[model samples]
Target: MSAASAFDDDIRRARALEQANPAEAGRIYMSVLEQDPANIEASNALERLNDPHRYSSWMRINCVIDPRDDIFRFIGTGPYSHNPIREYLSDGWRTLSELMVVMDKLDQPLTRVSSFLEFASGFGRFTRHLVKVLPGRVACSDVMPGSMEFAREQFGVEAFYSSFEPEQIEFPRRYEVVFVLSLLTHLPIEVWGRWLKVLAGAVAPGGVLIFTVHNEEVLRDQLGVKFDETGYSFLPSSESPSLEASQYGTSLATAQVVAEQVRQALGTDPVLWEECAFWVGHDAIAIRPHG
Candidate 1:
């Protein structure tokens, strides 16, 4: 068969199987993996379907028992103190809803999985969001001991502290949904490749890897903002205009480039890439192929 025809055929078959027997979608995905072990899309679909317990555990651990400290009360009274945790966590839920729209278009169910490993999980907000909306288990790790401790005490999440250096950890098991939000925008570009490799290794084959980064165009439009090389803003609200400021977000290409670099570093491809316009740039969702 011609490449175009073969591609069309596979899409039709995959869509049909997904529509007719969504529950058995994993089995069909396994066949796709058999054809190409490194097919990230197939691997992700299978992974999300097969791991129910891990996802459920995450929801119970993070959502049911929040671990954040009362840091929300510490921010000075102003726009900063206006429920930052709720604002941040709700943003993640909004993003997840956008992803669900895509899944709905593809005639796929947004099934929950065993565990979601949220790296750089600041105060476990993303973990909190996932457990609340998705119904899954969560394992959150950060480089800051204070962040982890605060998260544990306040949010009741199973938090761990692992530094960006050496880039290693000893988790009990590989996570099914590994996520990194507003994380790459904090690290130096040179460090991202190593982090990507580590994150790839952290995910079980057939798991989904979600993350965010900046787009240069958006950054260009917001020039004069005091931003780190990764385009992270450190300015307080009084110092800069809200539009130009980072506000813990970046442009689409900034994230896309990092995701590509990470894929190259890991030698794996992402099944899906969603560049939504919530804050700015792209917050992509990638799935590694099953072996």
Candidate 2:
């Protein structure tokens, strides 16, 4: 077989081995890379399998055996099926790729970033990849102390504990890139403004603040809620308590409402606004411009 065809076959085989035997899959990916250094798929697969911060065996068992954790339920749906570890690592790759594109759009070089912070990191799902992509100190924070500990131990990151109340939370230092993923989707409207301000405050001037929100697109597709004149919709945790509603439930914000909130928080409009920039899904991305 030709080089390209052989590479494709190896990738398929690696993917099949990934869930059942990640270490073996990693070796296959490494061999593919040796043959074709520029194989992005093989490189990404190898990285995911070889990540030092990957969840421990017991942690993987918990996610697969119990499936009670909200994080597992969120990413392990459909394609991931019952394999939460694969889902988790896949999300990290997807998130990193998206953020790189966003940074390129902003004309910000990932190499220039000296410090990165991932807010509401949730056991370092994305943090693990962030540490690999950026040549900087990657810090992760979450309201759950256990999650922070896990991130620190697994990823060798600077970990900190956050508070449920946004106003009470503080970072040790400013960051060139601050990412808030899946946090705003859970906050109530009253808490949104405060959290936005606090997270934006953590960004250094001329830096970028990236965040995700469940927008009207998600509301329509997932909840069967049509887009109304109002720019926001709230679904209490008591209502639909699955998927995006795993935690405090879901709040769907429109582009207009999210823009207004960012304006209120930063006193200026975002540099860029894109709907579904995350994984081509319902999440919206807004970037604060560099001064």
Candidate 3:
């Protein structure tokens, strides 16, 4: 068979394995390889069929697990609140491939900080990556205790309470870098302003505050952009927007406008905004200096 034909065969078989029994697929490939050690295709297929969850990199972040999977209460939803990273990765090959380029643009040393804070750390997918990239003391905080516990168990990092409410949790003397990926988008204007101020205060004078926001203008150009009927800022809604509800849950703005707002609210002197277009979304990286 031609190499192309063999490759096509592998793809078809792999899809079948995915649909039928991924577990069995791994065994089959291993069994075939034992019989004929020269079978490179079978070896490759087996490697490809290996469980994604088995990798430390994939499993170290437990927040990535489905929340509804017996650990958390289920409100009759099928499994969990949908795997965001899984969903993102489904279309994220290009995005994942561009990480090096993104890091290059940031140009910050990975080992510069002794401690770090990840706001809205989600399932800690990005946090795990950051942990590997950044050295020294690492602290992860999430709005959800479930997520914090999961991260603690999986990554072995110190987890802390991230809410504004008073709690026994004690933060370190200061953090060298405070990062919030996709966290600002969930906050309304007023709340975001407050968090930005608090975050600014938390950073050591020369540290970096890295964050992403829904840009107002570029989102207007996306295929399905819509405005809230409540006449608030243009927010894309799964359903119609109401005045009582703010756009936090439903709208995305252009990165440029978000950058501008951060400049006005945080510091006017030297905030750097970079437009990052990836497969999952368009984001701006705002590097704000502390104090």
Q: Sort by TM-score, best first: what order?
A: 2, 3, 1
Tell me how far candidate 2 lies from the true structure as C-alpha RMSD in angstroms.
Answer: 10.2
Clashes of each: 31, 0, 7
Candidate 3: worst 10 consecutive residues by lDDT?
68-77
| Candidate 2 lDDT, 1-291, residue by residue in tens | 114466888899989999999888888877775675434456556546754333333233211112223454455444534444455556667877787777778788765688888888876667767776663478889875377767766677898999877788868998888888877877766677788888888998778888887656656776677657876666766222333344466677776787788877778777766667786454546556455
- Pick by TM-score: 1 or 2, better one: 2
Cα-lDDT of candidate 2: 0.68
Q: Tell me the tens digit of each residue's lDDT in model 1 across 201-227.
A: 788876766666555555646653444
TM-score for every candidate vs. truth? 0.55, 0.70, 0.59
